[model samples]
Target chain A: MNNSEISEQGKLTIVGTGPGTDQLLAPAAKQALLEADSVIGYKTYVDLIRHILPESCDIQAYGMRQEVERSRAAAALALEGKKVCIVSGGDAGVFSIAGPVLEVISEEDLEKLNLSIIPGITSALSSAALLGAPLIHDFAVISLSDLLTPTELIEKRLSLAAEGDFVVVLYNPASKKRTELIKKCAQIMIEAGRKDTPVGIVRHGFRADQNVTVTTVSEMLNHDIDMNTTVVIGNSRTYRKGRFMVTPRGYAL
Target chain B: MNNSEISEQGKLTIVGTGPGTDQLLAPAAKQALLEADSVIGYKTYVDLIRHILPESCDIQAYGMRQEVERSRAAAALALEGKKVCIVSGGDAGVFSIAGPVLEVISEEDLEKLNLSIIPGITSALSSAALLGAPLIHDFAVISLSDLLTPTELIEKRLSLAAEGDFVVVLYNPASKKRTELIKKCAQIMIEAGRKDTPVGIVRHGFRADQNVTVTTVSEMLNHDIDMNTTVVIGNSRTYRKGRFMVTPRGYAL
Candidate 1:
């Protein structure tokens, strides 16, 4: 159960490769992938770093939403003395594989598994970078996906964030089957006295088909939003500066 | 102000070096430093990545809490046809140099200076990775430093995050002079029905002297905390699993 004991056993590492770009991947993440004996992840995220992955490593791809099954498989491999790795698109700890991987490892096997989680640039940070610093102040990150969390809780959180004047970043904004949650989110913010707040939308962040736009909260619905999009609703002080959306850090200058 | 015209001029990039470690720094951030004609940052952050910076790049180091002056200097160098880079300790956009740098560049000179903000792994993500998956769901990031933001606003955010049951990440938890704010934060959370909530504190994250601990919100004050510490107060469902602190994503086993 000690550090030395865990090092002698098989290790399971959860690596975040950033927003599907080689340049955005952290050196620690790249090092994890290079030294991995086997790699497992969702098909889309695996494809993002296919070029950076070592050819000697065994690769396994799972269909979307099969997190439970994939996690168990990766845990099993690590239990059998294989150096296993699970890749997440953004930071592993941010709505990614770290939770599932940690959840599947039983309490008894917790000490036996040498687990390592490496952080990466999450979508919110990348989206903020493209939009020119919309998160320079206090912020909240919320997901619109109701499959795991209840919609009512999401609404309460949105209202509280608005009331506290926290810049809000939303993940999984809209998909083919679920479009109403984002609409409800926009309505909640607008009704909470944020109708004129600056909103930055970055779809497919750091990718080839990336789209970045700055708009007011009232006009956010007119933009193209989908599953790949990240929406940042700015705080009261956030503003549009030419082509960039900025939130000042309360400096006198 | 068009894309082509802006590309033809000098560019200023605000780089996030990621928790003072070479391996944690993003490849894009390193590339920016490698190609930078001039590099400017606070002494602490600049020293974190000084070895990686190329010899030809002009280095400028500023004292602490001089963001306004440092930002203006970086902007002026970029205006004079230099590839200037301003580095921040964590992600540039997360309570770091991105705001000051963006704020200093006026609208008239905005087109003349091509600006690029490169995202890095913020301390919250690095801190979460070290202590296990404490940010797997909705969360709010608030700094305890009251120099820029008012104390009342920070208390409101702490209360709102606790009421919503969103995991909360606190940066700049305590310093020599500003120790009361973090104590106030713990009291606020405990008052909002989070008395025994799991709390993970990672100090000097990803560094040689890194320290990680998991405790309860009520007992968090017993531990050592300072400006280098990033505290992660867990949501309602978070729990301590052996040495790791985990927040489940509500997945059905």
Candidate 2:
């Protein structure tokens, strides 16, 4: 291997899988994965990009609810002069392990460690493309995973996004028992803005189900969407053109 | 050739140049461009990506302000059974030609045409990455380009963004003679929130002379920034940690 490759040998490269599609992975992400001595990530995330990983490279599996431990372990491995690829779904920097890994590295006081982040497609934008461009305008992405915050705060943010006339992309909109939060979000939005505003439901994003349904806030309120669904609420200018959901990006043609 | 490849031959692929770095370009985008029989974009955009253009490629050059014409030409070229690639800097879908191209294609009654928009790094994301992470939370992106729209609309968006307390990214903030728009944006933000809200200014985002400066809104009011600069205004939660500008996405460990 050359010097750049050799320099990368003992370092850590965090790659974003971009919502689980091999096509959505960035070039830098693929290169970093190709150069990795070993790759580690959540089970599903690892499976998402296994096609491009080196045949002989070892894979470390971290089951669900083990993210913090996995990040710390990956950083510790990198400190031993072994190339480690810490992988994440969606953009690594957004609601992913890049922060936790970086935090662990800093806590260990590992100085001058060569590291890089490979950007991936965020599920929001990728889904935005699949749905007919509800993100064509000024938008806001807020994850409703109040696992870290209270539900009250999430409700406040939803209201603020609606009040601001932002095309809102809601990540982690629903889980097995979390339909109420999304319902609350829709209610808050309706209260803050007009009720007939368009809302898009992108199921499985760029992956299999990939069901893009553009409905109004009232329509969204009457449904139950799964965890794989991303709920996009359009701003004031959003309109339905046939089955397509379009939000004006404030650029006039 | 495979059926998809054969069908893809007559389709249009709009690849994002991705903040002007080969490293930042997604592999899917590069692959689409490499497989293109013809490439169509602005002269400057073409120059930036000429090294990757295929030997068999036909390049149709459209100078500045000729975007709609160029887009129509690209669509027509594709409709005539040529694989066409429409290139744009940053993400093609973000403040760029992808929308215009799609608009023309749809408006001109080209319903049977297939189009794929591969997302790339937007300058807002790149600029945020250069600093610590200002976009860890939900944010708003507004382009102050009033070439086609009234300045009033842009201002209204800015006012809404400020009131939302979302971290704001200002694109096309100012031009040679339009230096006052950014000032107006800052003024709007100041009116909605604290005057000491931290503002991170990034010029030539992701490019070599990438200058990053963090100042309070009051300090920024006295400063001058141009269109090339991406102005990131922090929310109430934004704070400076050393030389980095960070917005807490949520409660941290």
Candidate 3:
């Protein structure tokens, strides 16, 4: 540890825990966890990897409503020279804590501590892999969560993805309060292009009880999907051959 | 081993060798190779994991034009119930021997040779991770090699990626015969959007001689980039703030 490392006694590494399994966590991520002094994350997420955490480690658990409080707690812990790991499901750098952690670090103590992000198996790529090759071409990832952004803004992204012939992956697709967003997304995609376009439903992808089903945009709108489900809607060239879903890597000449 | 183990013999688990390092290779991929009866890949790639490959296992080498022939040889070995590991750099599924071997697997010999593609880090993702955060939003990945697709089709995809506000990653951007395609790509991106958009030329992204530079779309046209480089053209949100190249993930929502 150099001057920068020593001055900032408390360091932070935000990690993506991967999809509900230890086997999926990258080796670097596993090593980082062992080096941490304190671990912080939502209680549900914390529970998933509690067994691996060291006996001397302190855990700061947060609930659904206490976002600010949780961030503050983690920050204060880091300021005290504790090695902190901000845990998030999937890759931390995505829709997870990467932004928030970076935000608090810059504002609170960038000069005092070290901060790095460890990439893990992002759910979008994981889902695409499990359901054949929907992401072999260009793709778009959008969060259906309207908690921060308005529903209108999400629609704009969907329109852009559809018009560009980009494969689209929906995250936070159908929370209890946001159930209608996924349906609205399907309607917009249908308006932009083909209704018969292939749609893949991978609920709990790479996790226990992982459900994979393929349907078209038309049929999917009528089907029930939940927050756990990651919906992959294929571009114009996407097709289904028997049980395998295939997305061409553009037509080879 | 038991009768079940004997029947499952000559198994082939094709693993991605990562872009070019030992640490980047997944633990599962390492395990698969240790368990393999024979490992086959391009001679160069096999050398990376030379220490781990068992002396008892047969090692086969193939050169540039010999990939198809190598796949056939590996599949034939798998048919005899040998645990075959056909290696490719980066993810086995992405433009590698994984799909080719799957295409060659005989339905009759399916039981004898179980083919599983163990994912390794893909070059696009590996490069993106190294160069700040080009993959923070929707993106397009296009290979400039016109061997399979026409140059015109590749150009069309480039246009679409720029128009769609994708942080495009250009692989095989330049080769001996095709020197100016990267410049042409920069020109199209400039026409599609703001000329000042940041473009990153990352050579050997995760290797020892890693060189990363951020230049505008206009500068990239004249900038020297080679086949070893992965060019990242930022979307609308890409900006140059001092020494670092950034593709902001919507700047704090």
Candidate 4:
């Protein structure tokens, strides 16, 4: 269906905001937000795009861990004949709100509601662009958040990605309760013969307060990483040239 | 450096055109392309955005396998005091032209040239949006192209991703000479105990002729897949609820 063809009835639109920067937001997402009768999202995410939203749009902001409630509210609003938009900070498909929104919708509601997902540039893509092409080859994106996933599973995935020599993008690498996961991730890569492999750590990538640093698996522990940081651990072929971290696309050069 | 601060000197800008759809392209990328003195990209990619480009902008289209030459030509034009925009079909950082552009830039040229990468929605994200929220958890993106990477290495990575229960997004799964690799990947996943996992195959995801299919790992080999298809193999938790393929975010609901 044409994304521009808005239905006469109320609909539920899922918008990927693309790394919290206005310039980074896709035209499709921007259009969805502009046309939304109501916008439901995390408090921080809503604030990121608050200025661009129309005054007629009803804004509901929820604190952290209220994802289910927010999605339910959005769906309920749509059921009431309102054009509702559920916004995600990154691509809704990747570790974002799309799953929760889908989970809250019932089978009976599916036929009545017009649901559309507007794609956005994920945080991995945003951070990778800033670090110059560290993800030019095969890669794995694993979040270190133990709140939802078990730490054992996270460690297992890290080891496997390192062993397979896939470039790895680690999200939520550290938090108040999970400071050691990044260190553990680095140790796994080091043990897998990637001690000297380049690692690009980007904080608030593409934003005004963005910070980027290039380090190695062995020295990653020395850097200051937190939940806001997006870490890219390069494969064996990834290297640092000047300030940029690059992984070749494996052309026969 | 602020991305908005454009220097008076000619510069090289790498633009991600976002899955060959105008609505999917980021505002930053569109702005860069509109202001460019010339645009260089693959013939197919150039044709995708021909109508939107400015009349004064010189367009150079190259055939396949000329990525190196295209990047070089764009860089040379930028060095000759022309604003050059090198376009890639999807996100320039993912299996696209960003790496080659970075590779050909010399140290001396770096000081004089302004290089910026405008991120776009990759095909994986586009396909995931079309299929539903199949990538809400940790995932791995592996290109099955054996042209640059060894088939043995691709097989190893596929096995590791399956063993770790990571959702996998396979790019370039099949071509004229690479028909058997997708089948081999399915075998590895089945051997790793994901025989009943859900699989989503999306072709030309966000384009006019987009097609999305949701099936099980056992039934995947029965579908018609090719280089144009982006295959998503779900983890153990992934399931099909009606037409949508969803992987839960593991919330304690």
Candidate 5:
């Protein structure tokens, strides 16, 4: 059946593929992709899930930093009575496409589009799984990409997270042009008296090329990390146990 | 082949079942449960996945607050050459079983047993998806269950998170015994100038009886919330767009 004949309103599924791993992908997300008439996402994310797309499904791939455009295009397609899926690497609700999609669609359009967000294993949780449990206690997640947010605001959040003794998860820590933000973040944590806190750097988490490195806040700069890495700085009670980096849950036992 | 004949070292898999929904369960977690010789978890979580367990697998169920005992029993079973799976609701790494499992096992035991953690959709992400993208910006996750964490510490973290303008996700917000904690949390947020901030309360998140309510910080206490609910309080820029609660990602556009 064609789009118009099948239903009056086409559905829009925002799918989070979960750290680019098939095993980590929720069953609902996989089912949504299979049922989608078209899949739209960043080129890199599209490549990650290319194998799973149905042969008849249309593919619309964009380059990085085209999130807004991609979301709008997906919404437009959905409004045209086509079942569309906008893909994100981790949980779509976490610094991903879900926000932008919601932002662009008006209230009337949203009601007509039949939108649903399928959650996935975010990088923070996936990285924590690989590095023991650094998120066992209260934690904060901050993105260091100053292109959208001001550097001063990022710095302020970092200092407050450190001061609050949160196990801070740093996303988009460093890119080609933003190479020094991670260092500044580490400096803020060091100044907040977490100089010796345990930190785990996980690159390409849950992928074949995954790399896990354990270091201290003061020594974080010595590692080779980039935008692909998720850096987890431990709280005051975080420690090293054998090869694992662990932050104890606040339990009396 | 029997466990001893197949391999000398038994396997232990810590699985996150993801908000009590089978569709939300990761494929890896489902596979791990099916392949296990025995499955162990809190009674509630074990019940959540009982239908998916293999017929041959033994099930060990424990009462609430038996996390340490459950992990120890699971570890001991693994040491005896049984493939064991310990389950947790939501992501095991986030305020869940991964920490206790790692803490209970010794270095030698860890090396002797094959251990793996399969990530799942955490309540924070699932709740965020259901409430729209309140987590698109920097966020903090704090558990208000002061049973383990002192009330003073939770208060301090709440104050700092508010001061930093971080989107906050509150887990274990209220229970029958802890009826007043959630009220105190709202008061702190209000005092920090977030009196009108958007708050989303998600109960039974992905389950059949799931409930979602959107309210302001000042009116949060008027809603029906319990420990099963995950509360998300928006930052300064959070707003109600239609039925969805959204927090902007700070894009320049």
Candidate 6:
């Protein structure tokens, strides 16, 4: 194996499963899971790939809001000379488990365990593909989950992204208890004079009950949005073409 | 076949090859290419997957700076009922061929040709994986190539992204003649109080001669940056840990 491959002594591989779809999962990520002695993740994300895990592979699935706990478990397993694979639903590097797992490893076992992060298809790009190419230019991805970040900061980002003419992708737009963040985000964008901008709302992308809608930013709040939804608000140049929403790359065609 | 699969007709499938690595390529994209009658892309990207293309598959590799011509060709080929696959080195939706191909088809043949876009690992996410999850928070992806976008707008986006505290990823950062854009972007970030932010520079990510460096934003310009490099500037919470650059997910560890 090359230098990029993990050595024999207890390695931790963080894999992104790519929108909970088997087909979207990268081959490298699949191989990591197949080779792992223990696979850990949130219960919902881990359930998505249970079919691919071997029977001998230990499946450690935790419930919601146990990110730190799962991360610590992953690091501890690797330190015990077990090849551990921690799974994240989308790309692990983007608002996912890689950071938390790395933080846990950095605390005490930085040298004993080998760490590798495998990239996956993030929701922004997957949603953009389903709605036509709305992120062809510069774009910003912000999560509306105020649990980690301040709501005011999220609002500021929405405003700035809109004013900069960025195609903005919003993850974790809303949850059951926090239903106002998406509405607030829409207000911030509209306040920045983006009321007419095209917005694509994709819920459970590439999964069962997947719904994709291309509408204007003004009408975005009228649709169904939840924690599973990914919202893409277009730049000034984005427009709807028949069933597709496209942002031109300014080619002189 | 599922509804997601194309019918037996002329179709255009835009595939993201994921940092030019076969292992990183998604199964959906690989399936699309394997079922394709003809494959077309920029010479560099096309050559990356040449080993996977069947001997009976017709290969059309175009030179650089021919995006419009290639998009038109892909659309024309699809209109004639040949399953054509256009490959992009990274995710096609991000500053690649998807938008151009969609735009070319939207002009007149929107209803005639079948189009499907399969997501892949973008350079930002792939480079972030190599750099140890520097993009675990909100991030902005901006391309420094001014071939299609105005320089002033690109500069404005960089400043806003920095001011908003987004981990910024720079794509197409510099070429032989376009060195000043990245330098200018560094100045903008520095002006926005990101001078000391952690910066990760990844060249030829997931490929031979891959180089990954973790440095501060102030020292980012001293690296060997070129068009093939992806630069990730960290947010205020990002820091270097041993060889890995990590942005915490605000989890109380």
Which number leads on DockQ?
1
Interface RMSD of each: 0.8, 3.0, 4.0, 1.1, 1.1, 1.1
Q: Score the docking of each candidate (DockQ).
A: 0.87, 0.38, 0.26, 0.79, 0.80, 0.81
lDDT of 6: 0.89
Report the lDDT of model 3 for residue B23. 55
Model 5 RMSD, rounded to 1 decimal: 2.0
Instruction: Estimate, for each residue in B1-253, the C-alpha lDDT of model 2 and write its tens digit.
Output: 6897776457887777777777777778788889888999988778878898888999876788787788888988898888889988777766677666656666344455667777777777677666555766667788777776578867877776666677788888888877767778878877886588888887876666778888888888556578668888888878765555667645344
Higher-TM-score candidate among 5 and 6?
A: 5
- Candidate 6 docks with a DockQ of 0.81
Candidate number of the best lDDT? 5
Clashes of 3: 5
Rank the models by TM-score, top first: 5, 1, 6, 4, 2, 3
Candidate 4 on A1-253: residue-level lDDT in tens?
5644455468999999988888989888988999999999998889999999999999998999988888889999998889999998989879989999888889789778889999888889999999998989999999999888988999999999989999999998998778888888988998999999999999998999999999999999899899889999999999887788889987654
Docking class of 2: acceptable
- How much TM-score does chain B earn in each model? 0.95, 0.90, 0.90, 0.95, 0.96, 0.94
- Candidate 6 lands at a TM-score of 0.96
Residue A184 CA error for candidate 3 (Å)? 4.1
**Candidate 3: where are CA atoms >4 Å away?**
A1-9, A64-80, A107-112, A148-160, A188-197, A222-224, A235-242, A248-253, B1-10, B65-71, B103-113, B221-224, B239-253
Worst 10 residues of 3 chain A by lDDT: A99-108
Candidate 4 chain B: worst-modelled 10 consecutive residues by lDDT: B1-10
**Model 5: lDDT of residue B104:** 86
Which CAPRI category fits model 3?
Answer: acceptable
**Tens digit of per-residue lDDT, candidate 4, span B85-164:** 99988898998899988877876886688888988999889999988899999999999998888889999999899999
- Local accuracy of candidate 5 as per-residue lDDT tens digits, B227-247: 789999999999999889999
TM-score per candidate, in order?
0.96, 0.86, 0.84, 0.96, 0.97, 0.96
Colliding pairs, model 3: A8-A112, A10-A81, B9-B81, B10-B81, B10-B82
How do the residues A1-253 of candidate 6 rate in per-residue lDDT, one tens digit apiece? Answer: 5653445479899999998888899999999999999999999889999999999999999998898999999998898789999999989889999888888776458877788899999999899989988989999999999998888998889888988999999999888899887888888888888899899999888998789999998999889888889999999989988778999999988
Please give, as one word, the docking class of candidate 5: high
**For model 3, how does the per-residue alpha-carbon lDDT over A1-253 read when each residue is reduced to its tens digit?**
6898676677877666777677666677778788889888988778878889889988777887454456567777877888888887776655566545444444337556566656666677567656655665556677787776567767776776777676788887887677788878888988986699999988877668788889999899666687777888888877775444567653321
